[model samples]
Target: MSIPTLRMTEDLLVAILLGDSTIQKKSAKHELKFYLPPNKQKILKMYIEKYKLQSLICIEGVNVETDFFIVSNSLVLERIIREWSDGTSVIFLDPRLLKNSTYMLWLCLFGRKVNNQVIIKQNTLTLDTKHTLIYFFEKTMRTSFLRLNAEGHLKVQAIDELLLASIIDNRPSYESLALHELLTDHSKKSFLQKQEKMKEEMREYACF
Candidate 1:
């Protein structure tokens, strides 16, 4: 299956990946969402230019992060799955690290979060078959999976990005040390360890 032409344009410049938006607090009844840091905003643009992925979207919380929504033709998501099966930008890493998950930022974000969860508009790409972003993430896709016991209350289900999100940084070898140090999450020792392992594997090009 051929992927439709993916053109990197301002229109495709969807959202920014700010990092673990995990809600650690439950003050009362409301579930607050995380916002992207302004400092990271510039860096996010840089990351997009650096990686040549203009279509990346911030998929953490319903309408785009700033509550800015663009009504346009988004990618037909199933095209990504088709391309992956046809071996496009699909990166293979240790199975333990990533099980059927493709690390494409768009797929990761789009499948999961919208922006503010405000339901500004129910926008969906025309997949080969109709599929909501959430449905594809939990069921059709492997990179993101729903928890085992959340079947009863599907709305509150927690999906896990099985692989360490750090692996998405596919910079060249010389930058490994820098990326390793910079991408560390001091809160999670395991996350840092995964980065260490990734840095090592990338050194020998074992995981590159």
Candidate 2:
């Protein structure tokens, strides 16, 4: 079988690198590996089909193990690493390359909704990478919606969820859409009200 040409993109490369995917090199060849639980096989399949990477993909331990992995015989990931990563495996992605919102949407996959906010766990990222992401988000959304939580993860509160959903090209998952709607309808107003109330309380405290 002939090797397929991978339809690689900067956004997709960054997205995968932000996820559970890793790059490995052997005998002058570089490959990308994605490890997922059995339940997440559909994600791997979707990526393979989306990128026209079917011929280059190899699946391992799908049926016999609780976890499985997919390997893509491509050098694209290595090229990205060379450009983006420091020698210590910490990525310092160039802010100029983050022009597409699709990657931000992809990053949301690693997030979980909490009390009308989406908290994206990015503990693995270097501080530089985190700052770059924050800069990119603010520049693209034209708002200061993204911030780092106390745990150093990326967070977007309810007030900005609608803006985020609107900017991304791909449709969000049903759960995310539902949450966005609920937050947009209720949380935005209440969040503002709370902020005002807090200011009033501080004024009262100052007077006392």
lDDT (Cα atoms) of all candidates against the true structure: 0.31, 0.54
Compared with the true structure, what per-residue lDDT tens digits does model 1 show for residues 1-208?
1222233322122211111221222222111133443433344455446656545432332345463322122233223323322222222112221212222333233222223111111122223211233444455344433321222111212121233543464533322222232222331365556658778888889644
Clashes of 2: 0
Which residue pairs show collisions in model 2? none
How well is each residue in 91-114 modelled by candidate 2, as lDDT tens digits? 776665564344443444344566
Best by TM-score: 2
* TM-score, every prediction: 0.30, 0.58
The superposed Cα distance between candidate 1 and the true structure at residue 48, in angstroms, equals 5.7
Instruction: List all candidate RMSDs to the true structure.
Output: 13.5, 10.0
lDDT accuracy of residue 103 in candidate 1: 22
